[model samples]
Structures are given as structure tokens and as C-alpha cells.
Target: MKIVVLNGSPDSRRFELDCYLAELEGLLETRGHVVKSFELRAMNIGHCTGCWGCWVKTPGECVIRDDSQKVCRAAINSDLLLFASPVIMGFTSAVLKKISDRLIPLLHPYFEIDRGEIHHRKRYERYPAVGLLLERATDTDEEDLELIRDIYARMALDFKSELKFTGLTGNPAEEAADALDRL
Candidate 1:
């Protein structure tokens, strides 16, 4: 399986998170799986302008010409995508949200009825399954985590993918890998 990780922590010196990701990468690689990761905070990704250029003018590609294209491409190509971010104000980091918003180009503009609701048409043949790896905030609670999970579950639906699991940074990397390995 090919996996891609989107790291959205803004701190440059994220020692524990960095080490955890490295461990996860190594575990996957040793199992003969390809793994790729992007530190979104360090990348030059711009916020989506909501112009619909990608859907209309560009046809399945963003016109911004930034690092987000690479992220989107990798994500679309992967079998699993793990979004790793620290909770900020009860949500994922803004950097992750920025790049995530940029992923709109991956879907078609036309809407289709899915599960009795309007949804964008899928542009690609396949999209990656998703997982969440979050570092809880100081004041985080169970309700906050549940809200985050529900939000990402909706995102998975929009992307035409499944959300496998949502784990926490406090968990050992081996445990997270084990959960993914089962999938």
C-alpha cells in the first residue's frame, strides 16, 4: 500500500510528532509499503480563492501553482492518507485546513445525488482512504474530538473515500501502525 501523511503542526521543532511520524514511516517502509509525507506548514500553499477556476477553467487542476498541487497529487495517488495535526481552537491546524481547502480541484463542479444529498461529482477513478492523527489541545474534551471526527467523516464522504480511524498522538506509533496494518 502507498500512504501519504500531511503534517500540519505549525511548530518547526515538533520533536515528538516528528519522531512519531518517522517511526510510522519506517514501519510502513519495512513492510514494503511506500510512504510519503508533507509538512504543510513549511510548504508554500495558498488559501483557495473560491473562484472555481479549477472546476471550470483548469479542469481538475488548481491554477494557483503552489505546493498544494503536490499534496493533492500525492493524496489522490495514495491508498491511505493520514492527516496529522494538533488541535487548534477545537479544530485542525489552519495550515491543514488551508491545504485541505485547496483539494477542491480534485472533484468535478457538477453535483450529483449521493445518499439522497447533493455532492460534487468525482473527477478521478479513485481517492485515498483517510485517517486522523491528532494531538489534543490543552482544553480538549471528548466532545471536541467527536466533532472533529464527524467533520472529517464528512470530508471523506465528499472525497469518495472512507475514514479508517482517528488516533491520538499520545498513542504509540506502533499502535497506530498496527491499526492501519489491520486495514
Candidate 2:
């Protein structure tokens, strides 16, 4: 599988998630899967101004000139797109959210009914399946994780893809990769 890992850790150098992702990358490579990753904080990603430029002025591309374009391309092309982040205030870090919001360019402005709910039309022929790799907070509970998963599940629907799984950094990286391999 061709996997693109969006490392949403705010501190790439200090976070243990970085090490865990590295191990997971190595394991995936051993299985002959192409693995690529992006350190979101290190890149020049900007906030989404909700200008709708990507949907109106320029279809399928954002007006902001930043590293998010690279992220969008990688995400659109990959077989699996892993969103990895440390839980901050019961959610993913701000940097990750910034990029995630900027990903609006990849969806069309039109809406459709999916499971009796309105959703955006897909802009791409195929969207990569999404996986969540979260690092829990000190006071993290099961509810927080479920909330995160539920939100990402809706996000998967927006992209016309599946929510593969939501794993944690505390778990062995090998196990995470093995889960993907099985899929």
C-alpha cells in the first residue's frame, strides 16, 4: 500500500509520537509498502480563511501558497492517509487542524444526501482511506477517543472513503502497521 502519514504533532522533536511513527514507517517498508510522511509543523501551512477560493476561483486548488498544497496532493494520491496527532484540549493540535481545514479545497462546493444527511460532492475520483493515530492526553478518557473517531468517521464520508481505524501512540507501532497490512 502507498501510505502518506500526516504527522500532526506540534513538537516533532519532542513528541514520542514521532518515534512511534518512525517505527511504524519502518515496519510498513519491511512489508514492501511505500510510506511517505509530512511533519506538519515544520511545513509552512496557513489557516483556512474560508474564502472558498479552492471551490470557486480555482477548483480543486487552494489560493493560499503554502505547504498544504503538498499535503493535499499526497493525501489525494495515497492509498491510506494517516492523521497522527497528540490530543490537545480533547482534539488534535492546532497545526493539524489548520491543515485539515485547508483540505477543503479537495471537496466540491455542491452538496448531496448521504445516509439522509447533506454532504459535499467528491472532487477526486478516488479518496484515500483515513486512519487516526492519536496520542492521548493525561486526562484522556474513552469518550474523548470515541468523539474523535466519530468526527473522523464523518470526515471519511465527506471524502467518500473509509475510516480504517483509530490507534494510539502507546500501542506498538508494529501492531498498527500489521493492522493496515491485514486490510
Candidate 3:
């Protein structure tokens, strides 16, 4: 399988989340899967303007000539998308949210009464599985994990992918290694 791992943490290689992703990458590679990792922090990604230019003006092309479109292309070609991030206030990092927002161009838009709603019905077929790694602080509340699970659930529904969550609280390295083994 060709896998694309998106590191949502802004700290890139310095963050604990990277340890998790690295372990997973090694596991996948050992299993004869080609892995390509993208760190959201290092890429020059811009915020989505909600212009719908990608859908209306140039189909499948984003107006923003940034690294995000490149990531989107990789995602389209990948067999699995591994999304990793550090839990921040019971949610994904801002970097991941920005990436997700910019990915709006990958979705279809339907207009109704001058309002456009994104239709992601076709996006699911490209990638059937998603592996999520979340690193929570030691002091983080259990409710935070619940909130993260809820968010992942919604993401799974939208992408039509089987969402697997590996929660690494405090001991990211060990937990990540175990998670990779389980995967």
C-alpha cells in the first residue's frame, strides 16, 4: 500500500507526535508499503478563502499556488492517509485544521439558494482507510479524548474511512510503537 502520513503538529520533527508517525512509517515500510510523510508545519500552506475557484474556475486546481495542493494530489494518489497531531484543547492542532480547510477544493460544491455546500461523496473512494494518532498531555482530561474521538468519528463519516485512533498520553514513543504493532 502507498501511504501518505500527514503530520498535523507544527513542531514537525521536534514534537512527540512525530515519534508516533515515525514508528508507524517504519511498520508500514517493513510490511512492504511505500510511505510518504508530509509535515504540515514545514509546508507553505495558506488558508482557504472559500472562493470555490477550484471547483468553478479551474476544476481540480486550487487558486492558491502553495504546498497544500501538492499534498492534496499526494492524498488522491495514496492508498491510506495517516493523520497525526497533538491534542490541543481537545482538538487537532491549528495546522491540521488549516490543511483540512484547504482541502475543501478536493470536495464538490452544490449550490442551493446562493449557498454552497461541500459534497464529499466522491472523496471517500480514493482512500478507504485512515489511521489517526493523537498525543495527549499527562494532565489532559479524559473528556478531551472523548472530544477527539467525536471529531474523528465525524471525519470518518465524511471521508467514509475506517478511523483507528491511537491515544498516546504522556508516553508518546512507547504508545506509538505499540500502536504501530497493533496496526
Candidate 4:
């Protein structure tokens, strides 16, 4: 499988999340999966200003010319898109949220009924399946993880995909790799 990993750790010096991703990447490579990872903190990504340019002005691309374009491109082209982050203040880091917001361009402005609810129309024929890999905060609990998963699940639905895997840095890298393999 072709996988794109969006590393949302804000601090480059933090090795806990980084180390886990490294191990996971190695395992996936050994399994013959193509993996591409992005360190968001090291990239120049603009914050989504809530402007409807990507929807109205630009059909499937963001108006802002930044690293988010690269992220969007890789995500849309990959089979799996993994969002990795360390839980911060009960949520993912600000960097992750920013890039996640920028992904609005991947959907159309028109809405469609899905499961009796409204969701944006898909801009592309195929979107990558979503995954989450989180490093829990000291105060993080089951509720927090569930909340994050629920949010990502909704996001996957919005993207016309599914959240197929979720893992933690606390777990063995092989476990996460195996989960992804099953996908």
C-alpha cells in the first residue's frame, strides 16, 4: 500500500512520537509498503482562513500557495493517510489542526445526504483511508481518545473515506503495522 503519514508533532526535539513513527515506517517498508512522511512543523503551511476560495474560486486546490498543497496532493494520491500527533490540551496540536483545516479544498461546496445527514460532495473520485496515531498526554483518558477518534471518523466520512486504523505510541510498532496491513 502507498501510505502518507502526516506527522503533527510541533516540537522537533520531541522524540517519543518521532521514534514511534520511525519504527512504524521501518516495519511498513520491510513489509513492502511505500511510505512517505511529512513533519508539519518543518514545513511552511498557512492557516486556513475559512475563506471559501478553495470551494468557489479554486475547484480542488487551496488558494494559499504553501506546503499544505503538498500535503493535500500526497493525501489524495495515497491509499492510506495517517495523522500522527501527540495529544495536547485534549486534542491534537495546533499544527495538525491547521493542516486538517486546509484539507477543506479536497471536498466540493455542494452538500449531499449521507446516512441521513449533510456532507460535502467529494471533489475527487477516490480519497485515502484515514488513520490516527496518537501519543497520549499524561492526563489523557479513554474519553479523550474516543473524542478524537469520533472527530476523525467524521472527518473521514466528510472526505468520502473511512477511518480504518488507530493506534498509540504506547503500543508495539508491529501492532500498528499489522492493523494497517489488514486494511
Q: TM-scores across all candidates?
A: 0.97, 0.97, 0.80, 0.98
lDDT of 1 by residue, 1-183 (tens): 899999989898767677778888898788888999998888999999999999889899998998988998899999998999988899998989998899999998899999998888899999999999998888999999999999999999999888997889888888888888887
Best by lDDT: 4
Each prediction's number of clashing residue pairs: 0, 0, 0, 0
**Which stretches of candidate 3 lie above 4 Å from their native place?**
111-119, 123-125, 165-183
Instruction: Give the per-residue lDDT of model 2 (tens digit) for 27-118.
Output: 99999999999998889988999999999999999999988999999899999999999998888888888889998988999998988999
Q: State candidate 2's TM-score.
A: 0.97
Q: Tell me, what's the RMSD of every candidate?
A: 1.0, 0.9, 4.3, 0.7
Give the per-residue lDDT of model 3 (tens digit) for 86-130.
877778789988987876665556522212444355533465366
lDDT of each: 0.90, 0.90, 0.71, 0.95
Candidates by TM-score, descending order: 4, 2, 1, 3
What does candidate 1 score in Cα RMSD to the true structure?
1.0
Q: Which candidate is the best by TM-score?
A: 4
- Summarize candidate 4's per-residue lDDT along 7-27 as a digit string, tens digits: 999998889999999999999
| Clashing pairs in model 4, backbone N/Cα/C closer than 3 A | none
